[model samples]
Target: MQSQSVPRRWLSLLAVPLFLAACGTPESPPPEDAVVRVVTPYTVRSLDPIKQGLWSPEWGYGELLMRATDDGRVEPWLLESLEPESPTSWQLRLRPNIRFANGNPLTAAGLAAVVDRHLAENARVGESLPGADVQVLDDRTLRLTTARPVANLPHLLADEQGISVFDAAATEPSGDIYTGPFRVRSLSAEELVLERNPNYWGGEVRLDEARIRFVPDPQARVLAVRSGEADIALYPPTEALAQFTNGSGPSVAVAAQPLQHLRAIPNLRKAPMNDLAARQAFALGVDYRQLAEDVLGVPYRAPDGLFPDVVDYALPTQRTDAAEAARVLDAAGWAPGPDGIRQRDGVRLAVTVLTYGSQPDTRTVAVAIQSQLRPLGMEVTIASVDDNYAAMRDPAGWDVGLSFDGTLGYTYDPIGPLRSFLTSGAQRNFGGVADPELDTLVAEMEATPDEAARRPLLERAQQIIAANRYVVIVAQRSSPAIVAETFAGYLPSSVLHHISAQT
Candidate 1:
């Protein structure tokens, strides 16, 4: 499904959460037939998909459609098939013999109700395309009509957003609601325990019970993998690489996906970016190779353009020219001043860039960026806001910030992110870039059924966004998830952090 536009105000809501340190990381998959241990960096706060971002693991629980990797196809779980009856409308055929974990029969009307409920909840939270973009047709077969034609409907449907269809009554007076592969048995500040859905429609779930033991530190995560204390985990840093040992003690598996858009967030309302030349200077000054190699590590490769893996249009380009940056700075009327920093009309070319230090690497990369910009006589102050990544959408956040985003779908889908920028309330627009040409192309791409016609528009959008340096395309990262041996069935689909299973 296309991304629901996030309001600018929503940007303020994205920030590093204060880590609720679990007493200590728990041991790996329990000996019991059904128990599994999964490790992760951040703790999930909400079971509601609309309140949190759609693809979050909290949304990817006991249910949701898993994407097939071979050709990047969509397969079903709760659904049997979702065939389109019309360009604007489609019929979702639900598997007839299915039941919720609570033994409620899975019905189409119940699914429709969940959709409406999620829309209402998100709309209240300032989402622009909430209920405004969806319509449910009937009880057995819910018909959906979009504001525009979307080729990525299955991708949208496969998301964890409203995928979990709960029985209508369970959703009515609930403190908690669930309909995935696992049912939440209990949860607390320290742990979240889940039991396999006995009535799961997808046959037998691989394991019986799964518990997510929160480990806030990357080093601790690595230790768990080696000690066989955890089955799967995210946020393994370079320091923890030794533990992998080429799939050592507890063998490891890794997965990586590069995002289509990276945030080169310059406050359009602020100076510098407001001065087009200043924005260009910052864009050209960045060195992509160093950041990718030093910060991202050996397995990582820099992106060529905006989208990675896909040829023509990628982010980490084969270019890193300091001369180009200097030329742009000079063209913008920036001359060397007493401080050796560029000054145009008595304004020093210095600004603070905001990013969270949770992962730790972003800050190191930011330092490299600082040294590169310093020679160009620009002063950069990089601050760790922890939860501050979302603040860029707010004009008051910072002069600039780092933005990296990607969606797991058939291919690099630019329509959603592009539309996010054009739509009035989109939370993704930190740089505040708006172009009629881009808007037109994005609209056409969304409505058109032809891939041949759409490719050029997507290409053009990436080119211009990169050319304008809206968000400096630092690197389209190849996603890397270092996992433990005891863990298997980690498909990177099914699960947002990592599709996992107990070996």
Candidate 2:
């Protein structure tokens, strides 16, 4: 379903900000500098909203012209309306009286400039969508033309990866001007302070000010919540659930999010993994249920497929059978070696796993997998690296990679993640997993305009991956937050971070 108001509203800016502000009446306005403190494990890689802010914007400093609604439907935020002129071209109508935090009027030309800069720097968006071009017709109207019929253009513009509009004249030290409900007062690597945007076109800004502190350490995050140093703790150590629920400070809030899938990528270019039978045996062998329930803690479900349950075409949960796994390994000519590790022609079944050190959960998962595979005659070596991608590039460096694989595509479509993993020359395709059948399905899904029509194709693509065991699906993760009882209006989706006071 589409939001009708946004599709037509893009045509005219004509006194919109004034009309909306005057007609809308807020029941209660959030107090000035109310200061809701939030501590999260995520790091803001860049202070620039256009770069890092669009994804997490942990401090809630910037706003995109459009955003995905609670249900993953596209809705206009800064833009008054968005409509497609053609399969390749889209027109965006600006809202009048929209100003940045610095009191600068956000013009169409300025917005276009920022988008142009982003396009120049990153070739992925344009290449992925094809002929992605932006043009400003006037102060109120802007046009975007893709090389092909991309039905999800609005979702792309408002995507979490980037595409947030910032002031073209913004500097590194001063940061960029934002048009969101909250404006950045000051932001350091360690902490960020945001005040209400008085000029917000969305009517009364409910949050007057918010303090977001970066606490990457899970233990530190839990401590911040218990000590009342933070009003909310995001993605703390899964084990810390007891501390919050056991009358510490706040209650744990859990939302089932299939957006981020924890999967193991077997290097397709490497030795044992190059054989499809070995990869399939690896997938069937692991005790994924035990890993999710016992090791990863509660609220996280074992992943059935790459996409989460939210997507219409997500595959149903598969049954795990160790006997079948062992049979496949034996059939593949792998026999138990001297130390019980599988071997074939003097080669041992030893695999190296790489993961990011920042996430405590990843380490716990790796260890659990290691334990589970030992009985199956597999020797797993864990290497926690600062950069998982860096390790992935070296074919000889690692055999299996454990990480979240579907976050980027969660907001809109599965094509983004699918293309990244399956595309022949795609940068993020760590294992060099290339399958012609999978590529054809992905291309068809991408080209198809109707979501309903694309469903079957997407399902088929996922089925192919499952059957071939190109990647090992471990568990689908839910983003859990520990929040104080007083906090309210925090929408628990893959996207959205800002909150309102209970009162």
* Model 1 C-alpha lDDT per residue in residues 452-475, reported as the tens digit of each score: 766777777777776666656665
**Model 1 alpha-carbon drift over 4 Å, by segment:** 1-34, 44-61, 65-77, 83-87, 124-140, 146-152, 171-179, 250-252, 260-262, 310-318, 389-397, 407-412, 421-425, 478-482, 488-503
lDDT of 2 by residue, 131-169 (tens): 566777888888877766776666676676657676665
Local distance difference test scores for all models: 0.58, 0.69
**Per-candidate TM-score against the hidden true structure:** 0.78, 0.84
Off by over 4 Å in 2: 1-33, 41-58, 95-97, 102-107, 122-130, 137-139, 148-151, 169-176, 407-410, 488-493, 496-503
What is the lDDT for 28 in model 2?
A: 44
**How far in Å is the alpha carbon of 419 misplaced in model 1?**
2.6
